[model samples]
Target chain A: MASHFDVAAYALGTLDARGTEAFEGHLASCANCQVELFELQELPGLLDTVAETWPDAPVRGAVIYGLPTKRRRFQHLGAATAAAVLVFLSGAVTAIGFLGWDGADPPAASEPPTALTRLDPVAEEPGGVRGSLESSTSHAWVETTPEGSRIALDLGGITGSTPCSAVVVSRAGETTEIALFDPPKKGERVVVSGTTPYPVAQIDRVEVRRVSSGKIITTLKAPEK
Target chain B: MTERAEWTESRQSAMLPRVGRHTRAVRPVAVVPDDPKDEWVRQLYRQFANQLSAHVLGLTKYDRQWTEDVVQETFIRAWKHADKLDQRPEMLRGWLFVVARRIVIDTHRGRQVRPIEIRGTDIAEDRVGVSDKADSTVDAIVVHDALRRISADQREAIIETYLKGHTVDEAAVLLGIPPGTVKSRTYHAMRALRRALRARG
Candidate 1:
């Protein structure tokens, strides 16, 4: 004594095996259920059409778990040969490069280059910075150092813009634009050491515009970073 | 060292027979010399590869290469499970869709530390007919539109059971409902979907 709902559900492959069996038992005696099943069969076809928008291809290397038994031995041999060749090449390159080097003295270890230190935001007065600029497109941020001598612009926020590109241009006509395929979300900060083109370190004057649209989303100036 | 060697030897011996059986199963039988199964798999790939790749790209916002990798992985799983699949070739498309979705989920989950949000873009606009293409004889768009009309919970229940291959128990756990409720909701949702698809057709 299944309902019409059960029959339709079974036909649509949404019902479990037990439900499907129950519906089929009802369907065996009821012409209405049979007709409904026929009708419901069309649903999968239609659903397929809606799913068509998202086309996907079958994955590869799924057929074979690993190398075929026959090929395994040959593969091992080939790998050993490759390793030997690589070792020989490395030795030859090292011999050629360091052939004339004196063994008497070891080179002194040079100190690593100093990393740029980030300034503490708490040290600066809260209202000392008058204007603020932010990018509307993504999570782009510009932080002014407490000393007002440098500004760090982290361009990590530009997520889904086509023809994705960004540039950091100073007032002195110095422009450095880098084309990013997948820009990091953690914003990269650029320091504005001094003001040349603009009187103050005004981010409002330093426009961050999309190359394609030419829309300036963020515009503001630091107190004097 | 001796115990370890013995354990390794036993494991290898156990696996050898299973591997042999697998290889033998792929060999052509006397009745079907050409092995229609292999052809069937190839045809499945040719028919669905591009569409599946598009769907994956839509969901992940990944490059075409990554989408291809997903597709490749899905097919590899299919081949490994070919014996189970042979009896259900008619259900192959549904199984592949489920497998592909699982792979996407697993890939995302594996990189849990960096959760990448797939941004919706117009890149997949042209391939919008994929759902329909899964079964072209029927009006898939109508069914889709009708699905939208249903309650979101109902729709999700139906999708989880069928498209996503969740068992009633699993769906119940996921939806935080009783298994009986899941069964009932799935039954009702399927009925609605079938009716809508039929009406459109």
Candidate 2:
């Protein structure tokens, strides 16, 4: 079925696959949308100028597949807690010094031990972890935490319920199973979290291995520090 | 002589371009210890880093560090799939934009799940919202601004369903609103933005 035409959606470059294909189909014959997409193109460029007001910072050699270096971890907080936490954090996190953002030197305000509330943690592991979802069949993120090593695997690599083992491999070549998960529903992008007893820093890589044949489906390696 | 002409023709063949440029045995020039692929990625990063930073900075609402990360990740993807990519600069730029955009949307959606992101979103919406208005005359750009001015509920509806690129059912699930509400907000958003823009004119 053809998706409904939403010009604003198209203009913002924010359309899901179905909507995009449908819009392009409509655009093939609709001169109007063509004209508008061209005009709207300038909007992103204009918005680009907003970065000028932002302080200059250097982005060096970046490892894209590395685990996200910065984010507010409100996930799995439950809706109510997430909301409450969001309310608390936004007001509390008034002026965290971002690297290259500024050097105001307000250490007391920025790093009060009380503010260490799991709101945002620096990616402190010498070699940070990164995730990839570019593959249509899989989604994953490898992360380090104070307690242990964690890997969030969105099992989309295959259809049907399959038993899979989440294992962490150390640089010294030790393998340990972290968790056994119940089979996720077929063809759904379900994220199942697994943790190793090993601290994330010590782990060399995390892999999702099929239990039946012991085939390694995918792996997330810790980047060199 | 006829034999001389044939000899000359054969001699010219030797000067013609060779198919196996690397087939000759020469002293191995010192190869860089690094993979040539790494060099390709570095070149791409140096060429488009500033532009990608600017574009993604707007999308990420000027979270400069996050924008830089997304930009870096985009290049990394380009590097990993270097064989699959067209070598043309425009194609690489488009590919980077597409990948970076998905990261932005994912980041945006992930942020929406948290209350903190919801708070700053209004501020972001208004800043970029007006910035878009100040810059262009596209009717859709006007609507982009007008969506921000509408009731937050209605705007959220449109944003989830439309701007943030969610389908009706998906947006419904994400927003905890009904699919019908998603459709209605989209309708109301379109009408309001059109009306608002017309009123301005």
Task: Please tell me which predicted candidate would have the highest DockQ against the true structure.
Answer: 1
**Which number leads on lDDT?**
2
- The residue-level lDDT of candidate 2 at A20 comes to 50
Give the per-residue lDDT of model 2 (tens digit) for B1-201. 453333233322222234564532221335423446656766777777778888888777788787876775566556556655666776566656655765565555555543333332233343332234432212222344454457888777755654454566688899887655665566566556556444432
Q: Which stretches of candidate 1 lie above 4 Å from their native place?
A: A1-4, A49-225, B1-138, B194-201
**Candidate 1 structure quality by residue, lDDT tens digits, A1-225:** 456556544544555545544544454345565555444544554553344332211100110111133124323446655444333323211110100111122222231101101122223222122112222211112223333322223232343335443444555656444222332334432212121222223322344455677654333222223
What lDDT tens digits, residue by residue, belong to model 2 across residues A1-225?
A: 333445445555455656554544454334454444434443433322222221110010111111122112322347775465444333322112111101111122322222222235334442133222222233344444445555544444443367877677877788988655545665444445555666644666666677888877666553343
DockQ metric, candidate 1: 0.10
DockQ of the candidate models in sequence: 0.10, 0.02
Which residues of candidate 2, in runs, are more than 4 Å off? A1-38, A41-225, B1-40, B54-62, B77-87, B94-102, B112-131, B134-160, B163-165, B168-201
lDDT of 1 at A139: 16
Candidate 2 RMSD computed on C-alpha atoms after optimal superposition onto the true structure: 25.9
What's the lDDT for candidate 1? 0.42
